[model samples]
Target: MSPRQRDRVRSLVADSEAPIDAQTVAAELSVHVTTARFHLNNLVEEGSAIAINLPPIGVGRPRVGYRLVVAPPVDDLMLMLVARLGETPEQREELAAEVGRAWAAKHLPSVAIDAELVPDPVVLAETILTRLGFRITDVVSAFGQHEITLCGCPLEKIEHELPEVARGVVRGLLETALTAGSPALAAQYAVAVRPAPGGKCELRLNLAQVADSTAR
Candidate 1:
């Protein structure tokens, strides 16, 4: 989420007469429901809002609603620095991704790959996440899909303020590691970031459609 996007979400929450649900936010902002929910959850984590169980109107479960609250004091130095990086939001995001790539490249191991010692992308991703101060709480895999749930991001502040960059860091880390050890796996799967509550996120490795001979 960019600062602009977050501000819009905040404004929506602030202006609503009643607590707003993520569906309403998504409709108002013209964003995906998941995107709206991610920001809403982030706001709750930041103490800018509170989640309440709304009275059930008609159905199976009560909708979760978000209500505005007094936000805690925030440090703006990092945001100020990010503003100076680029003239536009897209430029800043790209620059941030480059920084992520550089950071990953610097810290990742440089062991030469051998035919008998191919590195597993999931294992390498976990190692990188650990180095970045993330705690892996759950990992599930079946068939070709793999999911890693991480808690306690060291870049929580950055994630709240500039989520694109935070996502870029995750992407760059896995990408660098995958390309280094197993380009085949790199071509076979792509990693994605799924935001969750309490400064946590899910890293999903979705298998990409490729030729049978390519992934080998």
Candidate 2:
């Protein structure tokens, strides 16, 4: 972030209500909303802002809002360095995935142990990811395969070099679902990831494979 750009972003809402939208910022700054969105998006990527969508009372689309976040970027460089410190690509991926699983286990409610019933954990994954800042673009399900597209990755770093991070998140979500859901059925499930353009990606879990695994 450049000095002038940083000043422009910070000067917009030094003393305003939180969770403001780009439109509000543009209106106040007397600039186009797109321009405001650009700066706000930069702010979000820089960890100076948080983006959220508030569901409206009516039937229209939810309103997207931004909340200012004030914190030092202490972990920025450390995360980058640590993320690269792995013996091999496979080790790095596993390490990243482990981090994600740990995060989920620590943050999410404990799954019922030896309980009467275990529900589908996949359903819970969507909700958790949303709260963690991944927006669902669409869900496609057919022929016993389920696929979902998320608009943005929670990690701010570029997706190409650090796909392990995104993959780890998906793995974490699924592992938690499996632990919370049916272990037997979970053993039959598998996850496949495909990177998309613009910080987006697709996750697939195909139940069709369950039949094949059963045959084996």
Compare the candidates by lDDT and give the number of the best one: 1
Summarize candidate 1's per-residue lDDT along 1-216 as a digit string, tens digits.
Answer: 689988999999999989999999999989999999999999899888999998877876998999999644455766667667677766766677677678878887777777556566678778777877777887777776677777635667776777666666676676777777777667777666656545344333333334563643
Q: What lDDT would candidate 1 get against the real structure? A: 0.74
TM per candidate comes to 0.54, 0.53
Off by over 4 Å in 1: 1-75, 84-91, 197-216
The lowest-lDDT stretch of 10 consecutive residues in candidate 2 is 199-208
TM-score between model 2 and native: 0.53
Task: Provide the lDDT at 57 for model 1.
Answer: 76
